[model samples]
Target: MNKDNENLVKSYRLLTVWLLSLFILAGIFSVLLIRLDLNLSSKVTTLFWLCFVSFYFISLLLMIYKTERVYYINYITHKEAQQATKEERRAFAYKHLIVFCIATFIFVIYSIVSLIFQYPAAVDFAVFIVIIIVSALRTVPFKLKE
Candidate 1:
C-alpha cells in the first residue's frame, strides 16, 4: 500500500479505537450514576477520571518525548548534511512548537474545567498544576531527552 493509504488506514483505526474507548468509559459512568448514590457516584467518578487523565497525560508525554527524539535526531543529522533547508527546518520547528502549545492549552483547559467540577482528589489538582508548568516549558529549543 502507498504511504497515503497506510496513513489513512492508521488514522481510521486510531479513531475507531478512541471512539470505542470513550463509549465504554461513558457506559461505565452511566451505570455508576444510575446504580450508585449520587454523592458516592460523583466521588467514584472523580477518582476514576483523575487517575485516567493522569495516566494518559503522563503516557502521552512520554510517548511524545520518545518519538520526538527520533525526529530531533533526524533533523539534526539532515541539517548538518545540508539535506534539510533552513526554511524547512524552521517550518518543522514551528509546527512542533504550535502542536505543543495547542496540546498544553487543551490540557490546561481540561484541568480548569475539571477543577470547576471540584474533583475530590488533591492529586488531580497537583497534576494539573504540573501540566500547566510543563506546558510553559514547551517553547524551549533544547531536546527533551531522558
Candidate 2:
C-alpha cells in the first residue's frame, strides 16, 4: 500500500489503542469511586473532577494533534478539498465516522453505568452531551461553492 494508506491504518490503530486505554481507565476509576461510596466532601469531589476534566481535555487535544501530524492532509483548504480524489474524500469521511461512533459508544456506556449506579448528575452525562455535539458539528460536510 501507498504511504497515505499506511498512515491511515497507523492512525486508526493508534486511535483504537488510545480509546481503549481511556475506556479502561474510566472503568477503573468508576469502580473505585463506587466502592469508595464517594465519601469525600463536596469540595474534594469538585477538585477531583476539575483535575480529571482538565487532564482529559489536555490529553485529548494532544492525541488529536499527534494523529493529524502523523496523517497526510491534516488540513485541506476549500479548493483543495474540492480537488481531492474520491478515495481521499471517502477516507476522510470514514475516519470521522469511525471516531464519532466509537466515542459516542464509549461515552454512552459510561453514562449508562453511572446512571445505573445512581449518579444522576455525574460528569459522564455532561461529557456524553459534549461529545455528541462536537462530533456532530465536526462531521457536518462543508458546503461546496457552486
Give the runs in model 1 whose Cα sits over 4 Å from its true position: 1-12, 38-44, 57-146
Q: Can you give the lDDT of residue 80 in candidate 2?
A: 45
TM-score of each: 0.35, 0.37
lDDT of 2 by residue, 1-146 (tens): 33433343333565567678778887888789889896875534543554454456446545544444223224445344445444665556455546665665666566556645645454654765677677657745632211
- What is the C-alpha local distance difference test score of candidate 1? 0.48
Candidate 2 shows a clash count of 0
- Per-residue CA lDDT of candidate 1, range 5-112, in tens? 221211234335545776687788778877885766454456556556545544433443333322332334422313333344345455455555565566556656
Predictions: Cα RMSD each: 10.3, 10.1
lDDT of 2 at 140: 54
Displacement of residue 77 (Cα, Å) in model 1 is 18
lDDT of 2: 0.53
Residue-level error in angstroms, candidate 1, position 76: 15
TM-score of 2: 0.37
